[model samples]
Target chain A: MSLTLVLVQTLNGLQLGVLLFLIAAGLTLVFGVMDFINLAHGVQYMVGAYFAAWFTAMTGSFFVGLALALPSALLLGLLLEILVFRHLYGRDHLAQVLATFGVILFLNEAVRILWGAAPLSVPVPEILSGSIVLMPGLLYPVYRIAIIVAGLLIAVLLYFLVSHTRAGMLVRAGATHPRMVSALGVDIRRLFTLVFGFGAMLAGFAGIMIAPILSVEPGMGDQILILAFVVIVIGGIGSIRGAFVAALLIGLVDTLGRSFSGDLLRLVMSPAEASQTGRAIAPMLIYVLMAAVLFFRPAGLFPAAR
Target chain B: MSDLVSSASTSDVPATPRLRGTVALLVPAAIFLAFALAPLLVHAGLDPFYLSIVVRIMIFAIAAVSLDLILGFGGLVSFGHAAFLGIGAYAVGILASHGAGDAFLQLPVALFASAVFAFLTGWISLRTKGVHFIMITLAFAQMAYFMMTSLSAYGGDDGMTLWTRSTVAGSKVLGDTTAFYYACLGALILSYAICRCLVVSRFGRVLRGAKENAVRMEAIGFDPFRFRLVAYVVSGMICGLAGFLLANHTEYVSPAYMAWQRSGELLIMVILGGLGTLHGAIIGATAFLFLEEWLAGFTEHWRIVFGPLLVLVAIFMERGILGAVTRRRR
Candidate 1:
């Protein structure tokens, strides 16, 4: 690939990575703080996208629509926590898995019933919708750059909240020792609710932000959820910093592997054979990375407070 | 309470193993009779569609039971169990497409592929426990799903359809619906039997002990990790056999067969039936399938109700269906 193409792909990878971080940040935090395996976290992301898309279509303004959608998504998260997730705490992991998976089934079908089965889209606002020239000969979508910027901004905000705030201290405390935090009389249950809700909102935000470009459809969150899981596993569960770093690494590896694996293989093999083998092997690259990471560091690259 | 005392005394008086043995046979005997008789009572003379559905349920029951072995008894909670299923199905599908349509050859290839995949993935996954282990297994399975989807040579995401079922030593035994149903039933029964034996065996004791207290097991000089790994491999192989039956039943294999959702469904089956019990898987699979079928019939949005139902079950049922029953009987 040419230098311009390489640079563009690299940027694209970074953009994807940041989006993953947005999803994984909430997931890792929830896993860390609540010790709950919320499979429906992906459904929250899907809900955000669908809600944003529908609201934007109605309001005819992306920003206003997103502003409204965020609160609704958070409300939904809290409602779900109160109605269902509250009961799952202290249960075995298997129970949590089954219960959350049921949530996934319900939400995915609910979205399908509400929005119809076809894919929906949200429009990129005119101001940042156009392409921007990054180099002499290359142009990148302004929307993608916006995503990268927004994702990083959230990451910085998260770092601050998690490292500087009292709530963050409680969150970190809960991650390492829930019983001790409760013994300290910090209302651990409420802390867990807040963490779960916030994580849900973050996931929803990621979904809404990316809605303009991606297909907003039923089960949209499933694949990304798997990728986020990989990021956390590679980065170390319960570690936001690990999730961020690992998300970027996986994003780059997955995106670049898809784009260049075939061409890279062609250098040493016949074009047809390279294409076939590359296609077969490309999907496995991240998993191989995960396995390698686990092999070297069983806890993950940067395991959180735990 | 008096009856319990009398039964306990009687059981304590030298014939306890025999009594326990008879009780163990009771449920499966009842289930066997029902399944055998249900086909006879069908309105449309054993509607092929229902037969197919039941067969599918049986096939999945095998896989679910295997997963329960690792998750419930061994405390492994693998999320990539579907990968073994996919491996087995793909092996059958690929081999059949290449003219090796004989069940004898296809079975070995499927088993071997599944065992290898399980061995490699389990070797790494068993290192982690709880959620990390779950996610790692899930990631590995997703990798398998994506790889299968990318295989444009084999119909890719749409999946590959076998023109015909595998042959049995130059005979077309699998082509017969009744025969195939019985064959799958046989497979399911055999798997259940093997699991039953395994759970009470020496190996099963160690596996169960690890689940109860890994630290204690380690303290007692058992390397719980290795035992868990072996269980994982065996569980994976068992799921692979289920995959083989599934592919044979449907005559089609798709990436969807190994989706993480399917893995979740398998977990639901195990829990719904009862954790740490062999027959629970069979009941769970049947009940789950029938519930879905009935619910979907009532409303297209059945999962809305089903989802809440699952949450309620988790909230209220600490020991699951079978556990609740066994406790009451005790």
Candidate 2:
């Protein structure tokens, strides 16, 4: 393996990891705080991408598009929360699962109705479009590096806000004991609204950021949503820190596994057979990793609440 | 029905039968009988297409019933039950593609592979509770799904087509639509009966007890993990059987059959029919598939309507169709 290829792949893995963290942070929080399972969270990602795509196309400016799209995404999320999710809180997990599943079905089809089934793509902004040389004979895309930096910065900022701020403390407390938080005379409902809305926007932001590189289509978020679930499960639901670490871990594992598993297998066996087996097993390696994690620490590596 | 099963233990009253109990058992039996006799009565009138729909319903009903074995009765919500189904289907498809279409050999192979996967996944998944457990099972299922997608020798992403259905005593019986429908109906009824007996049995009592109060069950000397694990395996095996039937039913197996959406649909079948009720699985499958069929016939955007309807069901109707019916009787 050449050093340049390894560095490039590692950078790609980090970029992917950061994006996953952004989405998973919101997901784990919604899950931990409300004890609600939202399958439609992926659709919010889809919506964000679509919103960005549409706004960018209309105004011909990525920054302007994002400035307009983020709040709209947050509003849409809050609207859904008020109309549907609020009713589902305190219900059994089955109801939450079913209702959110319904939202997924609706939103996926709705997107298709609105944008057709063809995959859509957002153009990389002109300023961040090109690549920069990293090491001797190696170069990486500036946009992807930007994504990594932005994602990490968000993660650091989130840590500060969650661990050092009152809202973060309330969020932590609410995750463990919702009733106690309500009894403290804080408008628990407002807190939940902020949490849910903010989480949705974060997911949407990840979607928009990724739209340039990944295919933007209906049902695009479905697979990643499950992976995000894996990330949260391995990271501990409702813990942003856990989400960040686990998201990066899963992203690295999945990305690296997909890239090198065939080569790794070819070292031991004939090319054809190794490639076949590697192709078959590589995608599942992360899931195997998750299973191993859950087996040892059922609550995940860093559970935020009891 | 898990609700019926658990309510008996939770209520203060001992050994008192509610009216809803009788209806729960009877309503499902009637639905089963209707489907059982469907081919005989509609054989002359219905087209092959409609007959096949009923057969599809029977196949999914078997899967849903097996899912209820764990989700409804045991309260171990498994999002990856479709993995077992896919494993079973793929087993039959791969075997048949390799010229091993005999039921005796294919069925055991399907059951064994699915059982092993279930046991391994369940062993890890059952260690967690609530959302962790749900997500873990889902991840495991996704892993299986990815594996299936990578099996290029077996048609991989596009899916493998079975050249022929399972041969039973050197006959073409399964090739006939009516015969296959009856075969599936028979399997559904048999699985339902077995589930009925198993849930009321001593093993079942312990499983349901764990669902009600894991701490209490543990206190009383039962290891909820082992009991739930066994239930998970049994449920997986049952779903595998349904998968075997599914591959045989369509003579085609694809990764799409085991998609997470399929798992979600299976859960929908359980909840919509009335969770924890054995017959509810059948009812849910029938209603869900039939609704899809009817709605698709009416409009292309049926999902738009169906999604909101489901949210409404979750928000307003907590008990589901069967639960509502039974609750009113009480």
Candidate 3:
């Protein structure tokens, strides 16, 4: 890759990483605090994209549509909490996994039923529709750049909240020592509900933000959900810092690997053979990285010192 | 649940004092005997379609039963068990593509590939516990899934059609549905018996011990990892053999065989049959496949009902199909 192409790919990777962070953050917090394995969390992201698509068209203004989506997504998250997820807290991992697997089947099908099985698109807002040139000839999409900025801002805000705020302390404390937190007269159940709801909102927020750039369709979340799980696992299940770092690393490796694997392979092999092998290996890049990391550090890089 | 675990061990023996003459032994024998006569039923004008369907179920039963050997008895919840199935199928597919169509060659390659895959992946996955174990297993399976989809030579995402089924000592026994059914059935029985014997052996005890309390097992001088790894390999090999049979039954192979959803279905079958019970896997696969077939006939959107049905079962039924039957008998 040329210097400009490399720079653009790095930015693209960052954009993807930021989206992953938004999804993984909520996932890690819930996992850390509640010890619940939610296979259906990806559906919440799907819901967000679908909700954003519908609301945007209904309202006919991108800002108004986004404004309406956040609250609706929050309410939907809460509704799922009350109806299904609340009862699952004390169950074993198998039970939790199977039940949530069922939820995935239901929700994916339900979305297809409600929205028809076609992909929906949200047009970029006029303000962010054009590309900005970074140098003499290098150009980047303004909306993608906005996503990176928004994601970074959220990361900073999340760091501040998790490190400084009272509620954040409770979440962190609960993650590391739930029994002690409860013994200290904290209403652990209430705190858990708040965390779960907030996590849902974050996943939803990720969905809405990416809706304009990607297809808003059923099963979109399943693949990303798996990626989020990989990030969470590599980052250490309950660690936010781990999630951020791992998410960025995975995003960069995946993007850069997909873009450059064939060229790298061509240095040693025939072009035909090189491109095929490269294409074959590109999708497996993150998983290979994960296996390597896990081999050296089985508990993950930031396992929250429990 | 604790009682179920202990009871599972007792039932492993041929004639336990407390479990002598229990229906568990009787019911399983009757079921197998019926399966042995399934071809006869086809001769009696039973739908040929039903024969193929049941063959598919039995193939999956082999997979699920092997999964139970580890997931239930060995206390290893591998979320990527389908990867073994894929590896096994690919071994056969790849070999056959290269002009090798003999079972002796294809099946063993399938077994070796699957065992190696399991050993390598299990070595890493077993290093972690709980949800990490689950996700790591899943990641490895996703890797297998992605790799298979990118194998452009073998038809890639579209998969490859087998020109011919594997032959047994120069005879095309696998091409005949009745013969193939018996072959799958016989393999299931053999694997089930092997797993049952393993469950009753000393090694099985260590594996089960690790499942119940790894620290306690460690304190008693058993690392539990070695035993779990063996169980994992054995399970993968058995599932691999199932994949071989599955490839023959369908006369095709696809990347879908290794999809994460397929792995989930294997786990579900093991649980639906009641975890840790050998016979439960067979019964669970039958129930699952039957429900899936019946539900799909009702509508294209059958998953809507099927999904909720699975949820209800997970919530309300603690013991699964066999668990309830055995419980009521007691």
lDDT winner among the candidates? Answer: 3
> What residue pairs clash in candidate 1, if any at all?
none
lDDT of 1 by residue, B1-330 (tens): 223222322222211111245556677767766766556646657566787888888898899889888876787777878888898899888888788999899888888888788888888888777776877798789889989999988879999999999999999998998888888888888887887777767788888888878899899999998888888878888899999988988889999988988888888898887776666778888878988888988898898888877877777766567655655667
In order, what lDDT does every prediction score? 0.84, 0.86, 0.87
lDDT of 3 by residue, A1-306 (tens): 698988899999999999999999999998889999888889999999988999999988777888988888889878877777787787767877777888889989999999989999999988989999988889999999989998899999999999999999999999999999999999998898898889989999999999999999989998899889889889987899999999998899999999999999999999999999999999998988787777788778888988
DockQ, model 2, C-alpha based = 0.83
Best first by DockQ, ranked: 2, 1, 3
Q: Across residues A170-285, which tens digit of lDDT does each residue of candidate 2 receive?
A: 99999888899999998988999999999999999998899888888999889889888889988988888899999999888888888888899889999999889989988899
Residue range with the least summed lDDT across 10 consecutive positions in model 2 chain B? B10-19
The interface RMSD value for candidate 2 stands at: 1.0
Off by over 4 Å in 3: B1-6, B9-22, B43-45
Q: How many backbone clashes can be found in candidate 2? A: 5
Count of clashes in candidate 3: 0
Between candidates 1 and 2, the one scoring higher on DockQ is 2
Model 3, B88-194: lDDT tens per residue? 88888899999999999999999999899889998888887777678778889989999999989998999999999999988998888888888888998999888
Candidate 1 CAPRI level = medium
> Any residue pairs clashing in model 3, and if so which?
none
DockQ of each: 0.66, 0.83, 0.65
- Cα lDDT of candidate 1 equals 0.84
Q: What lDDT would candidate 3 get against the real structure?
A: 0.87
Q: Clash number for every model?
A: 0, 5, 0
| Pairs of residues clashing in candidate 2 | B1-B276, B1-B277, B1-B278, B2-B276, B2-B277
